[model samples]
Target: MNIKLIHSKVNAVLKAASPITLPVDIESIAKKRGLDVLPYELGPDVSGLLAIKDGKGTIGYNSTETRVRRRFTIAHELGHYELHKEKSDLFVDKQFIYRSQNSPITVDHQIMEHEANYFASCILMPTDQVRKELEKMDIDLVSEEGIKHLAKVFEVSTTAMSLRIDKLGFF
Candidate 1:
């Protein structure tokens, strides 16, 4: 899908839920959405997948990643569910997605990954609320610690927060 469509869907969800955050139990969300989420061993080449069978939906993640990383992975797959389910049967992300950002990949893959990242960020840190929270700080917006704090508040990795903040033109 197009960015506009993805943006609208994410934005609508954000508007409906004013403040979002990570460390969120995405498994619960999946269950609520009629999807089952299970932990399984995905090899080094793959991070996760959105699987559906017999009219049921599910997500599978690598067992080796840290809890925070697993949460992000689930959210990323959830992004595919909300935004790209109609286009592809699966989204097999690689390990160290931050590195993948610099690798040679197809434009379509890049776009989809970026959209999933965007969706993850918005779900983890609702822009409206983050803006309000940041108003109390007088520090440089792009500084390392500033981004780190944002990551802490959102319970996402520093890389994810930095990417989201950069995309928002906040620094």
Candidate 2:
């Protein structure tokens, strides 16, 4: 997948979505894109899913997950709606795709997962915003407490913050 292209697409979506706030109003952005966001008591293995029916799209997140994880799940499903709609009308974002040997289809599925995750990270923890936030911090991001503080500010999990930092080349 072309990572740069995904970034560009997400930027455009953000522009159209407008007034992006911290922790992001993902539901509002999805609504602006003509998609509905919903909460569901999904099975343990499933985090989120995207469904398109009658020419309308809906994203559903597992309500049982922590707030941050649920947000990520929603964004992940939104990523599928934005980038993989042509690939499938429905996407089940489950825990894992069992490994398969030398399967092109498996590779494609993995690529899609990566793309969706990147999309979610970019939207939620935008590089510019992250930099701006970091500039205002006096704490060292290398420490667990520091990372957790930043995550709290972004309303994301510490794990998500760390991954985004690594992706942004901030380390």
Candidate 3:
């Protein structure tokens, strides 16, 4: 699917809900959209599972993962719930995602994975919200230190924040 369309969809959801805030309440957002979010002692390799049956949706995330990772997992599952529910009612992310020599995934599966990932990124770190936060911070926005600090502020991983910065073309 188109990246811009993905972004717009995320933005629309954010706008229609309560005002955008730091450390987005992902679980609440999912719940607001009629999804049940829960923490489970999922398999070591599995990050999350999105299952929708009989019009009811549940998001199960790995409880052992870091708070940051769990947040992303929830958002990723929510992506599948929002964007791919029509195609299939289930999605599993490991590593937290699938793509291995042992169990190879088809191209279509790869595409869905990619889209869900992008959706997660957009939901968890909306571009406008990130830019607004950057403006309020006095630190150097391009440094590793700044990235780490922002990651904490956004409640996302440092790597995720770094990628967001790079993707926004601030390097």
Candidate 4:
């Protein structure tokens, strides 16, 4: 999948749902899309899953995970719902192993997972918002404290925020 295309798709969704406030609400967005967000005690390995039945969609995330993680999981499931729902009615996503940009995505499942991760990153830490936040802060992206502060502002895990910043070429 093309990274630019995924970014554009995320941008389109954001544009249609204009006036999105900071710390994007994953559950609210899912609800607006007519998808129910549910909490479930899924096993440790399973982060979340999406299911569409009878023309309705539901996203289930592991209740035991941290709030930030649950947020990302919901966004990831939303990605699958938006992009691959036509491919299958059910999508069960496990712990995502971060793949380097140059890694080979040879399988269909890997491709879809990669796209979903990209989608999650884009929506959770929008490029424009991130840039604006960085402009207001006088911290270095390479510093751990700076990453933590940014993560708190974005309501995401520090690791997720770091990856997002790196992907956006901020560091």
Instruction: Give the number of the best model, judged by TM-score.
Output: 3
Return the TM-score for each candidate structure: 0.79, 0.92, 0.93, 0.90
Model 1 regions more than 4 Å off: 14-25, 96-106
Q: How do all the candidates rank in terms of lDDT, highest first?
A: 4, 3, 2, 1
Among residues 3 or more apart in sequence or in different chains, the pairs in candidate 1 whose N, CA or C atoms overlap within 3 Å are none
C-alpha displacement of 159 in model 1, angstroms?
A: 1.1
lDDT, candidate 2, 4-35, per-residue tens: 87898789988887777787877788888999
**Residue range 69-163, candidate 1, lDDT tens digits:** 88788878888788877777777777655345576767787788878867776666666656765786677768988887877777778988787
Q: Whose lDDT is higher: candidate 2's or candidate 4's? A: 4
Runs of candidate 2 with Cα error greater than 4 angstroms are: 98-105
Q: Report lDDT (Cα) of residue 37, candidate 2.
A: 91
lDDT of 3 by residue, 119-156 (tens): 88888888888888888888898877888888998899
After the best TM-score superposition of candidate 4, give how far the Cα of residue 56 lies from its true spot, in angstroms.
Answer: 1.6
Computed on alpha carbons, the lDDT of every model, listed in order, comes to 0.73, 0.85, 0.86, 0.87
Cα lDDT, model 4, residue 139 = 78
- Model 1 vs. true fold: TM: 0.79
Model 2 clashing residue pairs (backbone): none
